[model samples]
Target chain A: MKLLEEGIPLAELSIERIARTAGVGKAAIYRRWSGKEELFVDVVRSAEPADPELPGTSMRADLVVLLETQRQRGVFSRQSVILHNVHAQMKSSPKIWAAYQNTVIAPRRRLGLEVLRRGQSNGELRDDVDIELLYDLFVGPMLVRSVLRPDGDLPDGLAERIVDTLLEGLRPVSSRPG
Target chain B: MKLLEEGIPLAELSIERIARTAGVGKAAIYRRWSGKEELFVDVVRSAEPADPELPGTSMRADLVVLLETQRQRGVFSRQSVILHNVHAQMKSSPKIWAAYQNTVIAPRRRLGLEVLRRGQSNGELRDDVDIELLYDLFVGPMLVRSVLRPDGDLPDGLAERIVDTLLEGLRPVSSRPG
Candidate 1:
């Protein structure tokens, strides 16, 4: 990830190259991982930052912290390439697909549920909100932005705006209590 | 889309078969469009519905109609497919991607902005919310839910929950004067 994060394109990579770069023998690399694609997936899965604490504070503050830390490294920055490769490869390989589901999608879903549950119990989130559906709200926009505008950066405060809009509602309505 | 919406997989598609099914000559299809891929893109685009009209009522009603109508057919659903295909093709060819962005992405962005602007003018939306970023909030979750959990169907009353949680604020405190 450190290598990919620094903009190492995977097309230029090889198992032999990775071995040399990591200061290990080619045979040693082969014994553990079958090839470059597998190695790349391993790199991504093992390298993702540990999930952040849910904080149990105000939902705003907790969510703000949850997103900001991710922004520091850029969400799915390096993993985007791996994801592209994996999605295509999965067309032909079930094992790769399973690995991706388990390693990538499952963990994120679990973490999202954890935060939402914490927010609910702490009175920082709505009791009626479906945590899973809400997780889609938390993640969907950033993913769309990344897909649509790959070259465009996630502009400053965009994450906060997303969190705000999702929590507060984007509907234009008078707040008066009539 | 009828095919896909009916659960036919992409892997099952063939040029001759699709042309036969649609009652067009294979050569006629090829002369205007290169292959099934281009034909599919055009089919989706041409079928996209116009944007929903915004009633000048409460913001919540306006947003609900906007969201629910978006699900009716066309635009968002078709655009989502285009985005998925574009992302997938990004790894393989630049040409397909450029076509996808030009035909699908730009138009969607424009439509989303229009929705946000209308909300703002009616005093139903926050003056501080960035329109473009707000567009992200509006469209992101819908697309994400479609892509990740194609079968999970957006749950009952989920849209209302999203609006209430976001607009009313998720904080437990009673800030509004009693």
Candidate 2:
């Protein structure tokens, strides 16, 4: 993991080199994983915390946790360097790539949907808001911005603003106070 | 340029290879540009069109052009692939790096400022919309979305919906119609 976090390209890795650096015998390393790619995949899998338990709460609180998880990974974690390398490697390796999509991306998206579904049930979000379409709108822009400006100022309170604005526009118009 | 659009790694480039591909001599290639890096930089420089002229009409019209430009680049263009490679290369090459900052990113930001300034002058946007911050808000999210889901479905009328929502929130509270 440290090797990958240091911007090492995963494709060029060798098991012997990993074992040498770790002060272990090649047999010990080979006993644990099939190859360097599997070892690298294991390292990535170990980075994510256990799946967060979604609380039965208000939409704002639920979404804040969800968005914060993304922000931490997307903006604040050391894993970003690993994610970049993994993103590049996914173009070439299918096994590692499937692990990434399933472990990293799918769960985060599932949480977003859960929050939206909760909001709909509670009447805080509109019945008309397409949960799937709203998910795209909610997530798409931030991912695009991060790509363009990896270290640039993330609009402070962006998730809050998006949620607030969308909720405002989506509420039953007559229910809105002046 | 086509090679980059096809996901060819810039690190793998060689002058002899490029020349053979282009059906030109090494001298002919060197005559046009010093190296593959310079040639690739030239490709990025060539693709940027002059900023669309603002029509000095409503903020909606002026902003429609600006937001649409962002959407096109953020979502549709192969320019993003070059943009990503430029960022990755900046970690290594300082000279090609500095040129990218001054040329590609800074100019687009300045163009954004001009559009916002026009919005304030024409009374379409609120007097206190914070042009610099608004630039970040308007442009940042679209880029974030693109990087995350390069091939995801663009929600129907998503662009117009964003513009409408922003227009509503940014307008003076008193200006909002029932």
Candidate 3:
């Protein structure tokens, strides 16, 4: 990651070079990670912020915390060159991306599903729609700003704003309550 | 695109090669596009489906059209090897990504904003939030399914489902009206 942060393209990062840089033998690297792709996957997972502890206060709060984690990651990722290189490399190399997806994305998705299930049982979320679809509604916008759009900003309060807006819906109030 | 679809990597694509493949002179390619990046951008734009003409029936209807276009594109892109290569290359090359964003993403964004604004004026949407925020809420979910999540599916009626659910709100109703 330090090498990636310094703009070392993932392609140029050989295990031997990595071991040398770390003052270790190549055997040390091969012992833990079979190859560069596997090593890259581990690096991304390690760098990612741990999943948030749900507040268990309410569905909205839990969702906010989940999104806030993404928000912070987005902010940091933008400031670093590693993500850009890693992301491009991951896409270019399907094996690394698959490993990353199975390890990182799948677990995060399960966490989201758990929260939505809790929301459903507690009467915090509308249960008429498919739960997976509901989860996408909650998580997608923040990700758009956080991951997809390079220019998207993760301003303070964005997580709360997203949750509140989705809960409240975009429908104009029949009459302004205030 | 032919080369890309056949699994030729972008790094190996050169104007001379492209011209040779197309049976055109290098000067002919240069006269049309400033460089390989510009030509690649043109190819992407040309390949992208034409933007949908809004139905002008209601905000819900219009939004469905917009999202449906994305859904179709998503489905097509997943099937095309060209996209996998182009997408990776685009992200790797800042210059190409910038040009693609400016020409493709910018106009798409403007269309989204326009639709959202119209919805607000017609009392179909809440005016309290910033319009851009509102736009993000509507577009973000579909994009997540369409762009960010590689395994996400774009089934029929997904556009309507997203639009309707968003308009209806996710808050549990005080009582089930149905």
Candidate 4:
């Protein structure tokens, strides 16, 4: 993991090189993992922040925690050079990118879907909106700030603000006559 | 454009190579553009779909058009391998990426902002919410599907759906004991 953080391209990394750098025998690594690919998958998993233990108070509360996890990750991704490089390098290796997607992104997406599903069921969310679009609508802004527009600020209260804002929306309510 | 669409890594491409490929002299190319980076920037700009001549209509109508433009782009990006490769290649070349951002991305961002600012002023949007967040909220889901989650569907009517959904919001209207 340290070796990768140094921006060593994954293609150039070998188990023997890793062992030599760490002053350990190659056999030690082989005994723990099948190969570098397996090891790398593990390393990235360890590096990623774990999913939040939801509050279970309400779907709203649960979503706040979920998006907060994304906010924390956004902070981490911006700060962690190791993580930034791993994602960049992973894209270059199609096999590794696919593996990472299956292992990391897919599961996370499923977890998000499940939350929206529950919210719809509980009448917290409107059932008319497609649950998948709802998930993207809720999650997309943080991601836009995190990934697409680097200049966009991620200030504190972002998670709550995003959830609350989406829950209510940007349109001004009409002032109905009493 | 043809040269780039061929998937030749930009680093491996040169003015001379481009000229030769196009069956033109290097001097002819140089006569028009100063250098490769400048030429590359223009090629990408031309390749991108032109922005909509927004209907001088209500904010909701205009916003729907703006998002609909994004939806069109989302469609183009998915279909055009050239676009996908250009975006990927641009990321690898910091200088070109900066140039692209300046020429291509920055103006589009301003346009989106201007529309939102107008909406806020004209009572289409809530004055209390940050305009930037509002911009991202409207634009983010389309972009998320466009750039982040490729498997996330970008079906027809997505622009209208996102706009209408956001305008009203996801939270179900309270039953007023009618």
Native contacts recovered, in order, as a fraction for each? 0.71, 0.14, 0.83, 0.73
DockQ of 3: 0.57
lDDT of 2 at B12: 74
lDDT tens per residue, model 3, B80-130: 777766787787788889988988889999988988899899898989999
lDDT of 1 by residue, B67-123 (tens): 555444423444466434434444355665566567766776676576567767777
* Per-model TM-score versus the true fold: 0.67, 0.67, 0.89, 0.91
The C-alpha stretches of model 1 lying farther than 4 A from their native spots are A1-39, A46-59, A72-94, A151-153, A168-178, B1-40, B46-62, B69-92, B149-152, B173-178
Model 3 Cα lDDT, one tens digit per residue, A30-128? 999888888989898777677788888988889999999999988887876776567767877778888888878899999999999998899989888
Put down candidate 4 lDDT per residue, A70-126, tens digits, no spaces.
887878777888888887777877777777788778888898888888888888888
Question: Which pairs clash inside model 2?
Answer: A140-B145, A141-B141, A141-B145, A142-B144, A143-B144, A144-B143, A144-B144, A144-B145, A145-B143, A145-B144
Give per-residue lDDT, candidate 2, residue A47.
Answer: 70
Q: Tell me the tens digit of each residue's lDDT in model 4 across B1-178.
A: 7777677889988999999998999999999988888889888777778888888587888888888888777788778889888888888788888888887778988888888888888888887898889988998998899788766698888999999888777787551111
Output the better candidate (2/3) by DockQ.
3
The collision pairs in model 3 are none
**Candidate 1, A64-137: lDDT as tens digits:** 66665455435565456654443455544456656666776688677667777877786666666567767767
Native interface contacts retained, candidate 2: 0.14
